[model samples]
Target: MVAQDEALTRRLSRRRLIGTAAMATAGLAVAAACGGKETSSNPGAGRSAGKEEKPRKGGTLIGAQVSDVNMGTGYPFVLLAENPFLNYLPVEPLVRYRNSLEPEMVLAERLEYNADRTKAVITLKPGLTFHNGAPVTPEDYFFGIDLILNPRKYGITGSFQLAGFARFITDMKKVDARTMEFTFDRPRANMTDLFAQLPVVHAASYEDVKNGKAVAGTGPYIFKEWAPGQRLVFTANPNWHLTDREGGPYLDGVEVRFFADQDAMGLAYEAGGLDLILDAPATLAKRYRARTRVGPKRGLVYAGLNVTSPLLRDSRVRRALFLAVDRERFVNELGEGFGTVTVQPWPSSSPAFNPALEASFYDPEKAKQLLKEAGFSQSRPLVIEHRTTQTYVNIASVLKENFEAIGVRAELKGTEATAFLAKLRAREFQDVWVTAHAFSDLTPVTNFQQTFPYQVPNPSFYENPTYLDIIEKLSGIDPLSDEAKRQYERFTQLWLTDPWLLPLQPTVPVALLGAKVRGFDEYFLAPGGSPNFGTIWKAP
Candidate 1:
């Protein structure tokens, strides 16, 4: 049986549950005089962070690459309404994100939830349009959900998010062109916010999706050009729906430069050719934060063992491997400072956390004794292979030495992200792999739903029956009042009794922004808890 955390921990170290929308919403309240009884009825139209600072106008932002989704029509099969990562054009789904990071309403004026998390009623801001000049309607929002619901549409397939959503959702009717009434099988507190999950597609183009073409999305910017693996460009939508305080995008275009490795991105950043690098390693982040015009990225690292390995089949053997190494010393090599060693899959900051699970410590002699008892004499070396990347080679090397000292023969299997993840997904190695997870949102269940394979992203190969049960409990759309606490206890018991994934500290990505860059923090954030560079820009 595997350990599971359905209530979700904030950090990835403990294999926590998926996080919900952020609790830290910015209180950028506007003057009551300027504010309306409810403000404009436009999508994402609420008065959020109506900053006194003037919006800068007229410059393209050039930056380095993070993940490789938007360089081209990766989803040519389903014409993407908006590149999930590169959102040069901003739009709304009633609730839009501030800096496009978390859910904040723009289109939908109000989000009212029923008591059971089964249903939600909404009121939208009126006269909202997409970058393509399409007027947004309730049918459009309905079509967005339909895109993901219809398997033939080939959208958000196998998502744990749909685990709850697929249950109670019933019908969406257009109360009027702008006002849509969404009813459910029971009650859904999250329905109005589900758009936070899938990118909204144009209802006018539903025929396109049925015809086997990707639907178009209305946004602030239109995809003008993409040069795969090299450079991609976007021209601002002349008809962009939202503008700055004074209606200014302040620039005509945005460019994103891709590099094969971080070193190249480093070179570009130093040469003042790049504005930001959202995908650098911890070691590199420390280097750049000290020497360059960059900032830190919030990242997580943990030791994940392949449960299928015969050598680690025994609980004693698994526990021995963990006790053998010095995680604190090893992580010191990355220089992100001492990260809170994960006691379990959840972050120590989460409400459901139990600090008692952090007791797993470094004990090499004990590790040696356990292995010997497990029948490993000097005749055989406990072979462990670690997969890694150039960014953390030094730390991986240190990890190898620690395990080797405890009567284990650990080999370095450092590979790049593509190859490394391929091996991970295939479960080809019998040892441990050091990796990080990009949390989807603030919701603990979202985190758990995602990692536990309740349904989003992709299913986990490390699937355990024990974990599956918890998934059923907490992932229920209409969760019981005690479900949160129950899930937390179940997860805590699993970790304290039988540790699965070892916890690690979270590190921030080191992003080097150029002098011309103005909106690095305010915008250019990634969606799904990962880095998204859609709002990034460069000088004209």
Candidate 2:
């Protein structure tokens, strides 16, 4: 899914089958040493570039962020806002991704697929213990899987990812104490992409975890403290199994300071109070050019139309709304020229990306005509609610202007980050909402099944049998094959006709690192583009 060279493509394709565990393990080490395509303005930001320096240990790495880590239900399954804190830091997944975006073993010692790929086996690494000092077992992994798939019973957000997994995995069985077998409905390739999303939890402490009373994981860090709306702290795990970096995490601990907004976070980083800033604003990027590292454009910013609404149910109205938005303006102004106007969710690197469909959808006059035909005009404008969060207020404002230009009345409703995300996940919005979503950088199946806007029976409430059938067929075929491309084209055409989710632009991921921060390439290049504190170190 990512932009890969010939070598990377061969390696990924070869490693997707059985008997390549040793090769995959070696690739992980190589990726760790070489990093990915993360480009820093400064010449000497990564290990393989400029002059290399030995990483110093025993210092706290302080990171500042505007969004508070909302540990909703204390489960790291659906809520992506908790990823930097929960996934792969304290709670480890069966596999971890390298900078090249290949899966590497974490809790899983071996992953094997049978011929035709309908069956698979996962062997857990032995002698693993949770942060609570309890042995890590196959049951714990199963418990986490069950909890995610049955979101209603767990009181957590229902995940499209688990639904995608359910489509392939018809049954699962515990083969032994350290191994589990999976039976799929059909042949499946690139199984690691699915496994990488599941983070195992200690079943014994799950009740406490769900209640927010305790935290237990088998990762490189142990959860220490969390002050709501202020900060979160984690100490190193001395016995972390991965010995690639001299046996354990380089930092003694990590402290994440929460700010009300990006400005506040940038100020803290400028004053030397914080060592890193995720998704740094353009102002900070310019001021600290040398210290900033720019990653791939992996997130899609789009408008999710609520098709259940009476007005939005009309195909004409949805098409008009999509046409009214100025995608170029949003890219140049809101994104500060750090994004590309896209007609679809997939990036240019993806096999699903079609250059023929990149034509602009912005047509104010056509939008006006469509609105008038749909029984709305300047005399009696169509009123709609526009839901958004603080981060997208400016984008919403621009959209409001765009809609008004087409003789439509738009009302902006802004909510906090946590509440906004909850509403999006629950499909609680009345009209339409604008938000950015990740997972476009992964496999096309993951993008369809993981992102809220792209999920089946999505928040938009728009459904078509043909579109569903195409997606189902696409899931079972080779992603790089001609048939897969034809399916993607058919699906894209169907989506354009309905226009449920209005495509906007793709934004680049940028982070500001302090002069002393080292080994952050993996964090920036990781899947989902969230920070992984395991390899990070603070220079003394």
Candidate 3:
């Protein structure tokens, strides 16, 4: 399943677990019944989101993860999309989302906009310092933007979003040590959300970061050791803003252990080797959902058709592929009713979600007709490649079976994550590939831009200038105006008609937590299944 990028690392696995209070099941039920009114925090918040237990001080929490931290640039380089759960703990953003998903002041005390809303002036919070004892400065903020916009020797993603900001914001100037001003070429919506996701680091430490040496930030944790494929260790930042009296990180330190198998991670958790299991198999998650926290994730698992490929170039073929697949069956059998069928990227919670879009019929006869009209037959079967995870392999198998029912022969190709990403970026594929793409920002513009044609290599070579223009126009639309509503509905229609990629379902990620752990907030689930470990403590 996909995790929210703005929050934590998104785990690809289906199931995971974390801790909860004695009344977790009842609380979760109440929260769900209320439409998440009380549990508005995003997924991966652990059990702390709804519990009232007073936090105590001092304990070490151990977590088991499936991926290794070999990237070495997990700190301040989360844009590279590696080890964000580890990297983001030591570094913080200027602003962050509260439980309401609203922008909350963090390092930046206040953010203001000009009359036209084209410029933003920010004032930093006083008395903030990096873990290395260096006071935070406006130069550090500018440096963070530069690192993302014009990255040098940094393995990063999100360049598109950063580049867009730099393109629209004509200039940036530091006013003082703790203040700065940004002038935009045009009015932009969701400015705080965009800036809140950038990782800030001290400018003086850029060289150290380039040399693979870790630098401390103003976050609650201090980097101690990153043992690559084994485990990562972090200690409490003594000089952090949140003091013990303020309910600051009650843990003395935190450890993240890496395991190759989900079963092994579960075993470690069951044997008390791990305090939390962020992701696990569905069967295992079923046992702990009542005791631990469980909820639906805000991401979608979809199939991206290679628009450039000969087999999938025809619109009819793409439509046929979408029509042939039984999304409801996939959700029922593969997802085991844990997920909801998705025809588009937006989750049901988002205003952009279209109810009518889900009514598309599963017509095998129509799919066969489209394939025949597109000049395809069993002799020339369509072949698609996907990542080789067991869960994804099973999903692909279900899709293959559905395609066969329509007299359309389909071949499934499985590969590792690294290889799959490399090939995808290179635009090397036959028909389509499965991916769990989720947007950290809830804005519809981001949903369109990321999937729209840009210079960078994306899964779908869906280059349409008109669609791009509409996306830009939507960005400036007044949220509550009739025009904005019209634009939203128009975008929905465009998405249903063209559908650059086919969304199968919104993944429901599970977490497993040990009974001793406390202050595990269910809102901690970021784009990745990772949580803010600093808020959590252990009971005596």
Candidate 4:
């Protein structure tokens, strides 16, 4: 009934699935040798380009967190954990990412998968301890998962990630104090990646963590102090397992100062008060490129349309609305030339990106014709509601003009972060709202999973049983296999055919580091999200 992708044009590449169990096994020796220094998969492979400066640790790194607020307790809360700005510092997961952004052991020493791929044996690194001096055990990991799945006791009622994880996972058992086994209800295509990303919490103090009394994590940085709404401080954990030349957490401490405004953060960065600004403006980033490190964020900034709305229910009207807006102009205005125009939800760098899918060109005349055919006239023009942040208010204004030129009246509805998310989940928009969502990881499956209602329900209300069926088939299949490729191709087609969200552009976030900051590229990266400043050091 809705648009779908064309027949299989090409198969999914094997390179996308290179990090298999065998590859992970091979990385064990290398991981062990580095002492969790976050070395690339290969030995003797260093990411630093210039003359390797030996890391000298001492001073505290004062930086700005991308998010205005942290949950205070990031572990076991799906909403809190999803934002990397909140957890990367205080909450350490079992699977730490490498310089290449590949999942490797941090807390866990070995990850072994069964031949059937339905079960996994995770052997934790021995003698690991939490920030509160609690010895981390397999019981703690299981308890954390349990708390996340059933978090009524923890104050959080429910979450999509928690519900989805509970639905797939069958059981988790402690083999010994250091070893644990996981049995999945169904084999997962990205099992290791998924498990590695989960942040472990101390079972002994789950209630304290749940009640916002204390944060008991095994991360490099310990929760030292919090001023709330102003500044949060973290001291290097003395008992942290991960180590480098300077022992652990190259910096003695990290101070993440929160700013409600980006301009204020930029001022702080320029004044040399802050060490790093992970979400610096494009202009500021360009001005400070010598001191800044830029990377592809692999995220989407788009407008999610309400397909259930009577005015938007028609496919013709939806297509007309997409054609009416100038995505390039919006990117230039809002993203400041640091963004690329995107047609589908997948970024250009993504494996799921379809080059064959023709870009939707802005055609006002054609948009008007389509709208006219849908029975809208001057007396009864199509009314649209656009909700977004003050940051993109200008882009929304331009979008309003674009729509108005095509005989559509657009109204801007701006809201804060929390309210915006609540609106998105409730589908409380009149027509469409300008918003964004990111991939939990680099996998194409995550893109589909986030959009699909079953896995991780998106703001868009569009649903199809056929699309769901194809995604189910993709589960546990080899990424390079013809079956997985076919499923991906089929799903891509379906996504194109039924565009619930309009993909505007790919965001290339800039991380502007001060002169004193070292290991910006080496240790302060989280593949698709914010940088992890665990091993970052300030020049002595």
TM-score for each predicted model, relative to the true structure: 0.69, 0.86, 0.82, 0.83
Of the two candidates 2 and 4, the one with more favorable lDDT, higher being better, is: 2
Candidate ordering by TM-score (highest first):
2, 4, 3, 1
| Candidate 2 clashing pairs, residues 3+ apart or interchain | none
Model 4 misplaced regions, further than 4 Å: 1-52, 65-67, 72-76, 79-85, 99-102, 207-213, 244-247, 347-349, 357-360, 376-389, 392-395, 426-430, 450-457, 523-532
lDDT score, candidate 2: 0.68
lDDT by residue (1-540, candidate 3, tens digit) is: 112211222221211211111111111100011122223222333445566667887888787677665343333543333353565567777766433334557788878877667888888989888888888988888776666566543544333334555556678998988889998878776455456566677788766664445665777888777766788888888777756433677888888888876677778777777777654556555556544544435457777787777767777777777778788877776665665665655544444555545543477777787778788744476776777756678878888888788776788989876666656655676677886654522444545544322222455877656556566676765443445545666555455445567767665545567777766554432222335556778876
Across residues 226-341, which tens digit of lDDT does each residue of candidate 2 receive?
78778878898888877564345889988888888777777777788988776777667767777777666565777888888776777777778888889888776676666567
Residue 377 miss distance in model 4 (angstroms): 6.7
**Given candidate 2, what's the lDDT at residue 96?**
59
**What's the TM for model 4?**
0.83
**Candidate 1 vs candidate 2, lDDT winner:** 2
Candidate 1: tens digits of C-alpha lDDT, residues 403-484? 7788677666666544554454345655566665533222344455433222322322455566667655655432223456
- Report how far residue 78 has shifted in candidate 2, in Å: 2.0
- Model 4: how far is 251 from its true place, Å? 1.1
Worst 10 residues of 1 by lDDT: 28-37
- Model 2 residue runs over 4 Å out of place are 1-35, 38-51, 99-102, 155-160, 245-248, 357-360, 377-389, 523-527
* Most accurate candidate by TM-score: 2
Backbone clash total, candidate 4: 5
